[model samples]
Target chain A: MSASPGVWLAAIFTLAIYSFLYGDNPVYKFSEHLFVGLGAAHMAVMGWESMFNRAWTPLYTKGEWWWSGAIIGGIMLLTRWFRPIQWISRIPLGFMMGVAAGLSARSAIDSQFWRQIQSTVTMKLNTTNNIVYVVIVVCTLAYFLFAFNEKSGLGQGIKGVGLVGQYMMMIAFGASLGSTIMARLSLVIGRLDFLFKTWLGVLK
Target chain B: MKILRSSVPIWLGVFGGSIVLLAMFIKIPVHVGLWSKWFLEWRVILASFALTLGAGNLLRIHANRIRMKREAWMYSYVTIVALIGYTVLGILFKRTHPVYSFIFDNAYSPLSATVFSINAFYISSACYRAFRARNGHAAVLLLSGVIVMLGSVGIGYAIWPGFNTMTQWIMNYPNSAAMRGMNIGAALGIIGVSLRVIFGLERGHLGGE
Candidate 1:
């Protein structure tokens, strides 16, 4: 495949970064610094655009005067650098902080707690798979509880169950690790594909 | 006497939080409740400033590095230039412009992918040492990992189709169960933390006066 100038530059940068696998070097450092700068710069540009489209347009064009409060508040955030007015920045900072807490709490409670309990409670235990799932979940949760004295008979039983839970966790974690390796390998494969097809013209 | 120090910020936080939380659950007539909608829009504006704080911090660090002439500080110049150059280009020419996309595609994309991909080598190295099954628990983990790996690849299926089924069973049952337990625990923690923030008990974000 014929490659463009941009593609050639991309290939060069990719190789420069890949050199880090062997050892730390100037090329890797250069690429790393450039990447950091680019990422931050992109975020700043996006923030500007967001302010324009989302904040500025509604306030000026639509005559949403109350938005001026937010604009003022957002500016106050900059006062964090100045000592006297730093307290004022907390007004906006607190506003955003409260909003975030509300949003996250609402979602977490709904999606994670309520929904999961619903699923667990509604399961049909007639099937072996369903039974095993419930048992494993119970045992896993038991592993986290340390209140029971291990020397007691009941505590020993719980410990035994928790040990089974531990084994199950290891298997699950192993699968997760396996999946991560596959993902990482896929990235390598993608780079190798580009090198061969786009840069070297070795493979079609 | 100490209203500003003690009460005002808490009231502000409560008021701001109530505005957002109420809007989500309560629906008001558009004509009368335009004010409620304004709070959401205000949030977006306020959020942008938070974005500025992050970039500003990064710039401050690099600028300080340059001023002090720290070792390899020459790289700081490259970072500053790239950051300012890209931000200016984006504002002037827009992100869709050829030069912007070219820089993004070439400089940013390859670097990101390469960084992530480099982890593959470390993981492989770590796996070689860690996967040794000296104990029973380690044996189970290694067995699961091997089965999953072999099952995922084509060569594994070529060798034994049962590898895939074994992997499917392990993931679907044990993995799902463990993950569910973790989710429940994490969600409870999130709820506790969120409540603390909403109730003004967590003043950590407010910093200091």
Candidate 2:
């Protein structure tokens, strides 16, 4: 019922995608491929924009020659397709990976490892709930200890704690699953709202 | 050839990783801090290039499929045409152009949303089949999942006020505890692997022996 061409196109595309629910068909296949194409093109465009702004502009306009190294590395990355000079691509890959590794390692140690431990240890167990929370945290951590022998007395205690931890984890996973379902359903609702209200003009 | 293929890359990895890592602990030398910052920016540029390369790979695969006239080859033509056409439109007029925005808003956004929304149906079907309470653990999982799912929506509060309270308790205590424990373990694993990669002990990324 929408008069706009854009709305009409969107409805058609949405319908085309949803057609897969009925089973694989030509419309769904076409839409799937088209989606891939558009997605890839969008990525390429963003990449080009980044290269132009970050590397090209600085290298040419600002005369920052160091950025030229990035440009070279970017170009070198394309050599991955060529079997003869594919090894040349490793340099950029290595550089990128190293940077990623370094950043991740630093943040993981600082935020996840040290900060998490500090917070866990420093939590005040004044209330019953707080005490239960602390105990659950300890139990959860115990569950991850794979080095203990199950036959030993210490291991038996750990195993009992770990079972409680396992149950807590299951409950957590359930909550997570429930949250994901709700989120996905919200998207579905949004699409349905668009189809009915925007496209069909059925709802006020 | 050996150096280019192996040794040089390993050395570059070490240099790149070490400079960034060292800069975190060492703030005295101004140049080291500057280089570390520059390296991070360079990574963005490199990642952009990687994205473009991925697009190129997509093009190659589709073009090859079309040439070979394989199964569902007609779809390949659709992909190729859309990819080339959209890329040209975006490059020529830039992203802010009305035509580009129209295509993105109408085609891309709707398509993406619909694709994700489709998962709702599949997930519901899966839950119906898999959410049977076979044991105490299973019963707890099912009950928690049901409570949370109901409490999140308007109908659950209407049904029972206690649902919301129970949902909050499960999320605050057990959920938080489990996630924190998992996060700690994962962090340690990440640190170990990252250190290995930085030191060139992990050569999997280099591709092939």
Candidate 3:
């Protein structure tokens, strides 16, 4: 079956955008704004859609009485426009913050602290890999004990530990950077290939 | 007297904020009010305005760079040209139709992705340098790194079953614990900051005199 008009149009447009990889051109800029404007428009429409489907229709047509509370809360979110009434907007902000805080507090306990200690304490030493984990944990922890002076025994120990942590962090950062670059290159290649093979039919 | 002057705004902010919080739990059988909906929508509008301001700032900075003929002025020129070109095209075509779609899939997508793809080589080099065993703690880290790395590839399975198990243990246990603790602290801190803002105790964001 042949491709639909919409599909062909989208494919051609995609190629137009891909032409940008060679250098800065008019086509690339056009694509960039198209993405931004579409993104903004989509978000605005989504917000309105949610409010209509969730609040308006339910309350007006179906007579879902409880929706009034949501409508009130949502309206309160708009009070920031009037300088005199701006403080009224804080009502929803407070509720959002409170809920967010509670959720984060519970999640944090399970994910960050307890799990870290559990892993550190039950570490393996027999295998080469386990040995590295054990060392990293110890050294990284040691590096953080900065209460002591550099010349003193305790100070020197903590400093040494911090240095190890620093090294590990640097390594991680470098790896992250490399991955980012590779990702970018792949995108460029992908775009180029799409333009040439799909739209122009120059290469298969 | 001075504290009261500063505290009035804080009290109002806090009071309004608290009411909103209370509203969430009170299922009064009545539909949620229009006030909540308005508040959310208003925030989106305000946020959009702020985004426009940010874009303006970016443009201004680049324009200045070109005018002054600063180092890498050509790059600034390219940025300005690109920004204007895209903005104009979006306005002119005025639709997500074919003409507009062509620019998006080919240009912006590639730029964002190409910049991100260059990190793989940098990561490999970084990893090699980091895995060196200098001390007891360093040694443990080195060991964990190797295990995790090997486990990620098929080699760990061929080498030893224990390597994969150990790597999983490290990630599941210690890594998670540390991450969780940090997350908890961050949540608490966020709540505190939010409360302060609600109460107007934190006026720093407002840029007060």
The backbone clash count of each candidate, in order, is 0, 0, 101
DockQ for candidate 1, C-alpha atoms: 0.65
- Write the residue-wise lDDT of candidate 3 on A164-188 in tens digits: 6555544343333323444445555
Candidate 3 residue-wise lDDT, B34-115, digit = tens? 4444334433433443344345566678679778988655566555655556555555554365655655554444434533
| Proportion of the native interface contacts kept in model 2 | 0.78
| RMSD (CA, angstroms), candidate 2 | 1.8
Candidate 2 chain B weakest ten by summed lDDT: B125-134
**What DockQ do you compute for every candidate structure?**
0.65, 0.76, 0.10
Model 2 Cα shift for residue B156 (angstroms): 2.3
Runs with alpha carbons beyond 4 Å of true place in candidate 1: A1-3, A146-160, B5-7, B18-41, B134-136
Model 2, span B36-107: residue lDDT tens = 888999999999989988888888998889889889998998899999999999989999999999999999
- Candidate 1, B48-90: lDDT as tens digits: 8877887778888999998999977878878888888999999
DockQ for model 3? 0.10
Specify the poorest-scoring 10-residue window by lDDT in model 1 chain A. Answer: A98-107
lDDT of 3: 0.53
- Badly placed stretches (over 4 Å) of model 2 are A148-157
TM-score of model number 3, chain B = 0.78
Q: Which candidate is the best by lDDT?
A: 2
Candidate 2 residue B61 C-alpha distance from true site, Å: 1.3
What TM value does chain A in model 3 reach?
0.73
Which lDDT value does model 2 have at A24? Answer: 97
